[model samples]
Target chain A: MLKFDEGKVLKNMEGALKLRPQINEVIDDVFSRGFSNVCWLGIGGTYASAMQAVVHMKERTELETFYENAAVFLTTGNKRVTKDTFVVISSVTGSTEEVVQAVKKCKEIGAKVLGFIDKADTELASLVDYLISYPLNEQLKFFMVGDRFMYLAGEFAEYDEFYSEMDQHFAKGIVEVEKAADEFGKEFAKKHHEDAIHYFVGAGNQWGATYSYAMCYWEEQHWIKTKSIEAHEFFHGMFEIVERDTPVTIYVTEDTQRALSERVARFIPQICGNYTIIDAKDYDVPGISEKFRGTLSPFILHAVNNRIDVHVEQINRHPMEIRRYYRQLDY
Target chain B: MLKFDEGKVLKNMEGALKLRPQINEVIDDVFSRGFSNVCWLGIGGTYASAMQAVVHMKERTELETFYENAAVFLTTGNKRVTKDTFVVISSVTGSTEEVVQAVKKCKEIGAKVLGFIDKADTELASLVDYLISYPLNEQLKFFMVGDRFMYLAGEFAEYDEFYSEMDQHFAKGIVEVEKAADEFGKEFAKKHHEDAIHYFVGAGNQWGATYSYAMCYWEEQHWIKTKSIEAHEFFHGMFEIVERDTPVTIYVTEDTQRALSERVARFIPQICGNYTIIDAKDYDVPGISEKFRGTLSPFILHAVNNRIDVHVEQINRHPMEIRRYYRQLDY
Candidate 1:
């Protein structure tokens, strides 16, 4: 009962791209106002997007940065967070146990709290010190999963040049995502039939995608053994593992340092017991320059990933697996 | 030449364990001075130690930490240090391109610098704002090959209650390590041949050991493939890669946490194309822990891991491998 089909996500993504520059300006303004350290807090797709931003910021800035699990806030009673610290708490639905608790912690610690939410009235928006809003529309296949909304969070900042370019690209992104989703669905299902285990590899920020599509959806939801690894680091020795029982999927993006990305992709088939590549270019994304418009690519890619997650749930005859080997993880 | 003979390391290691409490106290003192963050600077074996220590600290403390390649100081011309940040600089020789340049950065940044050194008059000693001594007497190995020095460090932290116990158990430990090394030498060499591919696995602090011995030393020295993975985490999905083409080695402690350690060991042989297990308890690290003491296990485990590195290098047939890779890694 969603108003927009998966294809419509392509346009929302364009709008999201248009909003990114503004988001960056807002972030920079807050960053200059006096935060010395940055923390990204979220779950699932938003969590993944947060991770990507964390890694990118580390490479992009010399200052201190971290990705914190909301659980840390819930558990640590004596934790010290100061006003000099920049804490970003996000959730697409604007409701999650850990995130809610973390916002409370950030307030107590006197840190600036920035939030991104899909709904204006959501709890996350109500609680954060500075909140940014996005469309609340849900029930859409892609939106049902979180993260695409993160890409939509770009309007909160002052950086407009990049957003304008992304705005232009957003209109056509939906078809590409559907195409990517359909292709991925067929390929993933076909591979799932042959192996009980699956592995996902994303280097650097790709871990964001790897964690969501592989660990959360594929492995956690379907009872498949899914794993993620940094790309360049993989070849030094892990090549031996790929040719065995694990069939790995590689997430390739245009923004990945070109040489490193291609080098890792080329080596995948060598070590993977078997392998497949799912590529997203800037053009294929809601914008150009994989990173220029963070809003468009992550939301589009994650939505496609989400669509496949749904497809796998539908086509598979296997039992639904709810595994709790230990309490450290959740689906 | 080092003052240590074939058996002298065992003697000093025994001596060092007697000094463990003060050693343990001082190790924490390195970080107690209250900086906003820490940057570990070093090269080669010394840098290797810093790498292991930084990771251990990150896993232990809530504080932010990072590693600065000793070489980056050479051309970056960036030295903005402050009370908000500090450096823990290490040097076995006190003379390295990056280590020397780091001193200049420390001066430029106006941040306090702590030098961890084997010699009092090293270049690093003269420049450091605070100095920590990791001295080895003429009767001991100094910075030469063999891990007696690092092992003794482990003993430094838990010298009181564990000294006599370690003395009683050490001969057995040495014998076991020697036996494991000899057997490991023959089999591992045959499998790796001249390719220089190796894998190391450890859990908890042992993961630090794996990173140093298996990844840093093996790969840096030989331009080979060496990777370290968290033992328990590796099995969640990665074990399927162990095949005939690649081999793995693991480091374990006798009193390893029961919940995780045992399960990982049980599955080792199933996936390691080839594998070996060396318990820190029996790894023959003279000065390190004879038995798990009250302090964190990393202190003891890291020293034993250092010893394994020396032993592996001592047995390496490719003598020039280290020299060949040095240029690519010298910084």
Candidate 2:
């Protein structure tokens, strides 16, 4: 595998699994303390991740769950976010200015904040009331918090089966998915690395992944021009921009909204000659129940897309970490 | 005003105001009949408009309001959208497949639907329990419905003053705004109509305007490529793709989230030399109160951006209503 480090991957996945007890404890403490509502607060990519969790919470529970981007929350306060609100936030750098400001505001209002941070020695890490160190598994960690809370609230009945299977197969299955997707990723990167612009589409839980991958990875990391359309919104106006030779990719999930992107997948072939479909259903994750496959498609996608990112970076000769303006100058 | 029709604009705006009595009657009847929650449903541009209303509702009221794109709602089905749910939807064509399907599902579940349609004879008009013909005032009509509901529930104290002012000045003031913005719009279109791609940034209530203008107008109507980034999310990744000569346009509003876009505006000039700032504050609605200005920024932006659309259409020599794929071809 190109640029692949199996040991580090396994270590991180194993570490995420090891945090189950800690995650459960945090959820238990938050429940015991009693919260009026749950507010998922994050900045940029983290906000997209929070949106996925909020969508899940809305589907499975009657719990009052609100998802807000950190900057919006900081500027325009939510009346629902009060002292009794349980706020969940995540940061890879753990020092994103907006997230730090939002966390400070939450602390000022006495809201209980559970923060997932990669770095343990950052401003956001110190601001959070309950901290969980999730160096690699951001979405997995978020699902653990949300699903455990829903289990206690009687909204998630399959919590036991889901996590039990996750413990057994998730780490290894994900690595296998990465290796499986490596070849296709290389071909895709080789063909479309220098395309004028890439149009990406995804639906259901993968919409956040679609948005984040396009903005955070393609635009920021790879310095590529791209537009991400929600599978549901693709037909509304975006389809008009498609041509026979356009570089298009539609990500299909095994979720209930599968048909939404499947609709795009079917239509794209009719109009676009150059297209790619990254269906989560194509990936095999042993030991995970069929009923719970939809819930984990995003993580499946993460594995598949990580391979593509590696190949794209290598082919383009552009380091994913290079940035022209971000964190280099004061705005 | 190149290609502007003042008469048609005034008639449409006035017509929307004239529907106030009918709109109030529908809301009064819905309130008397009782409802559990409000669900704003639409596809694409209409969905974006509903988002602006949802943001306003979230800011001002504690009502259980859910905004869902019609396609997603049609497939996944919200458990919260029940027989007692007040479903609000808008469609220009009123024959959008997914919206009609979602409306049918809502009907099957006995949900009362209030639909805003431009055409009175479309299929959606026959399906909705309550219909309001809003040919041009989609956002205004949505605000009327939401603000009226909030007023009836005692959540909006300034509702009386707000509507009274809207009735007096909204139509004419919006025309003035359009006229005021025509020269700037003409110059902007002349300068950037042929740019490779336009990057649009907006926040708060005006974010919907930003999104719709970029996708519905730029991409769909004009066949031009564009990427609309939320103001709060701009610094996240989109800013990295912006060069000194990148054609970036940031939409600013007078809402609580003003600071969010303002921050983007402040930063864009520092990096991108070829950037346009379309500030809603620059275009004033004479009779509207200062306190209510933020609430009407989307409409103000509509007036401003409409001028830009006219010029872009004229400059690009593309008919705004011409579509290669939309209604002409069946997927």
Candidate 3:
């Protein structure tokens, strides 16, 4: 529980849960108005977070969903993004230049823009056709947006039930994650602190969480060298880099592609002695249905890993919020 | 040129060029049959190679094009892929298991499957509705496939002219690449040989080449750790890892998104002293049109970097073909 604020975490989760009705209203309004496809646009962590939702929608529904980089989308216009497209833009700061420009482009194309902003009076909130403002927490931001996408993709009733369950036992999930952190954080950090490179592998929806942790948290915040490889692609070429003590974290989620992670699990110990498997199935979430466990694994895994972030910060003596170049100098 | 095979290179180039007309025929035939959308499917390096083609098609035409991971697609089906979808499958050996499975799935869904196979008789070649057999050079494979995609996406006459030009001076481009490799390969290897991690930054079409070289060649072949960060995304988070002596390579291509690369070009030298700029514009590719330069940069860049592979092989004493786990293990 070092450097942890339990009250803040609870408040943030509650605030995110409060946005459920507003998000549902936006989804309903957009569908009723008629849209050709859906685009989830953001930069950096925001883009990474939306990707989990994209994978969920792609698997469960026939809705056309695109997870695009805000800046890259500007330079290379997508042919599928038309006047009738519905765009969901996430920006906690509400001033990310790339997301703002993307919102402008979407507006110019006559697409409906929904903004998930942390501040109500910000530029992004003003620009979007519909806005949902909540407390700024990366995990909560993704969960809310992902929930909305799954709902709009025709899993509304199922997701509503799941969300209701989460509402009742949200505090328990947090407490369980914190307990895991207290048990594993120090050991994980001690084992990996001096490692020059870390390979983060995950399959299915957990791939986004794995990527976000590697790029947004480790590489961006701690300036550590990390490569986020999907479990399926890990065998193709990346496995060659493995050594006896190569630092590897395998995130196992409950999904159709869990076998993919299991394959890596079986193979890694054969080559890498420093590998650690963080299986979401290890966690006990009260009131969550078995059907919804796979869908909610990313959120749970992210919370568990957030503890590792705190421990890593303490062990490495590198403040998690410090960045060497991001927003420090003009590029 | 150290380890250069001029005759074999010319032969390979000729063989790849020979497939152009056949590839075009397939494209024409597929369009004539009337398809709803395009699905470019592959895994690892193959998937990375198809990404540039997907980006080109997305930008130039109104066609809905998807660049999907073969194994991931098998587990989580794409909503856009339907009976009317024209799925393009690339497998050099004609027997990548994931791709074969994906082809089967596409066929099951009644989609027309096109296979780009290296051999005439293989499981994947047999399974696909149409097959184009050719020598498997990564650059050539992508170029041919990308050209086919562009043609199908409504750039027939322009791409046709570009192909004609490439066919004439194809040898010249290879020769120019060999010369650059001869000049710069040893130096690049010497500077980067001791580095533990490499940051490969590229934008536009060059992003695919950068990712391929990083994942397939460096990590797979040499067992050297590398992070392939898109130029636009570099500013977002990846730049935080930069140090004064961090090894970095910026791939600059002549495309609409050249500015994105240029942004990194300007920033990298300021933050990292051991940085190299491999600009495609630096090479003199005789007889290739200015309009066609961006389209062909991947090929030129791949050839130039092949020398780096040779030098890295020599300095690190790691045979490019040696794999610790890939294909050797049953994962």
Candidate 4:
């Protein structure tokens, strides 16, 4: 049976980059398309990647983009699909029931499908007009998720060479990734604060990663609330939720999306006056890949996330129970 | 200046009755074609009504049923609309941007179009081959918003005269609605327990309403964690979150859909022992139409939601704030 794991998937990202030479082609397709709209589609990992990609794309180009809420498919819809739409459809093997269904609809509707598949002779390959394939060898199952992300990030950052450089930089770090995590854990254990709620704020692609890794799964696992939001979006309405007690953590990086996130971070000191700001540019580690490093950056962002949980656990003196309420809603 | 409120709705519910006279026709139309599937599309108030109606239909019929989550267009969706697909396009005026787009696409796909309309010769009416018209007075907004819910519910419950009974029930309850809310507030205040987080759960149509007004908005407004899940789908996972301290309020009714919810409620005691359960069936409010009453049976639910805010404000609790660190993701 195929199973997906968070920690393991994040750690082994190297295998996601055999197609690095084609990075320029994809990036060119993105730039060639300009500030036009895009449709990011996938189930599970692909969905998560699309969120990050769309957010990041918007951050760089200031172009309008939309996310297809996955829940919508099961609820109510039969809207027409358009071929003009740039759909980045990602699947490890390029085959999934929902993804395949979506792909077929897109093809029929004339939407340009940019297929990201891992396996050979996949249906998605024949379906999409443009294709990018990543092999994802076994050891990197732990890392390929990040690897896939870094490849995309490198394209977006417009640094094919810079992206190439990052693969090596990240791999060296992965060798000692555990020691780094342990050391960070030790430091976090001692610096625990009471009643700290983390706000993982970013405007672009990182916003997507922070949301999935930080907000959804992490909070569920640890019972600690982490709100990951687009920084500018935060300013419009959510900033008011800020107060003295709430300690916000901003995940910063040098990627283009940083401008908005940084601006929001700058205002935090003035508004609520206290927040932990980690400049992601200064701290980068990966065995995954460069494109994905930014996407998977939040995994490394556990310095604050872990400590907050450990500290809260130390204080609540209770084990964390991830609560997911799925009660019946009948007539 | 346009604002949509459920209470402001006329609740005349005449459209439902007017449509009832043609119930056999609609039902015949529904079955004769034996269409592959059905699609319902609407926006805002009309959208909510469509949701309620679809859920009601599912509970009343044995035919395979589901809702497509039309994110951009309530009516247009990913499911391929074909000759056999019956498109149920709902628009108060049939002029909403996305609705129009979807209807046009439905025709493009050759699906039979059915419209729930307010005006004769209106855009949606002209677009769909089959037209079901409501009294299109300016006052129909009320029917569009909620009163129709009563009509649909009454029809589902086999109460043919329920709408007129509703006119009487509401006329009576109108005199006491405010007092009821006030009474509800006081009762909530008296037994208000601050020991744990308030968990309000619902599934299906009520679940949609509760999702919009209660969980998403309420949780964000008060910084209290509230989640809603689909009933039957919840059994797959997420049942483990229930605990003794966390009260699970079950909104119950005698409506046909109650079978699933009631079954789930019956199992709750075994799963989470010693939890406070709110079963609206436990209360008595006179003159309320059976289906309407079954629904508003959760009237006290409004006050229960309010009490959560009261407690949150009393605690001065809020989420943290942060500025972005890096904004390097693509736009």
In terms of lDDT, the best-performing candidate is: 2
TM-scores, all models, native as reference: 0.56, 0.97, 0.96, 0.47
Q: Model 4: iRMSD?
A: 11.0
Per-residue lDDT of B220-268 in model 2, one digit per residue for the tens? 9999889999998988887888888989999899989999889889888
Given candidate 1, what's the lDDT at residue B36?
57
Writing each residue's lDDT as its tens digit, candidate 2 over A65-158 gives 8688888888777777889999999888988988899999998899999999889999789889999877878888888888988999998988
In candidate 3, the residue pairs with backbone N, CA or C atoms under 3 Å apart (3 or more residues apart, or in different chains) clash, namely none
Weakest 10 consecutive residues of candidate 1 chain B by summed lDDT: B138-147
Name model 1 segments beyond 4 Å from true.
A1-4, A7-32, A42-47, A72-80, A92-97, A117-126, A133-158, A270-273, A282-304, A318-331, B1-37, B40-64, B67-295, B299-331
**Model 2 pairs in collision:** none
Alpha-carbon interface RMSD for all candidates, in angstroms: 8.3, 1.3, 1.3, 11.0
Ranking by lDDT: 2, 3, 1, 4
- How far residue A197's Cα lies from its native spot in candidate 3, in Å, is 1.9
Q: Compare candidates 1 and 3 on TM-score and give the better one.
A: 3
Provide the lDDT at B242 for model 4. Answer: 53
**What is the alpha-carbon lDDT of model 4 when measured against the actual structure?**
0.48
Which candidate do you rate higher for DockQ, 3 or 4? 3
DockQ of 1: 0.08
Q: What local lDDT score does residue B298 receive in model 2, on the 0 to 100 scale?
A: 87
| Model 1: how far residue B23 lies from native, Å | 13
Q: TM-score for the second chain in candidate 2?
A: 0.97
Predicted candidate 4 versus true structure: per-residue lDDT over A1-331, tens digit per residue: 0122335533445545444546446545654564234556654444555666544433333233444433333232223234455566666666565577767777776667666677748886878777766654222222232233434544235445445555665445543443344445444434433333455675444555565544334344444434455554454234545666565767775555566667767777765655767665555464445555554454445333444455445555555543444223221
At residue A169, candidate 3 shows an lDDT of 80
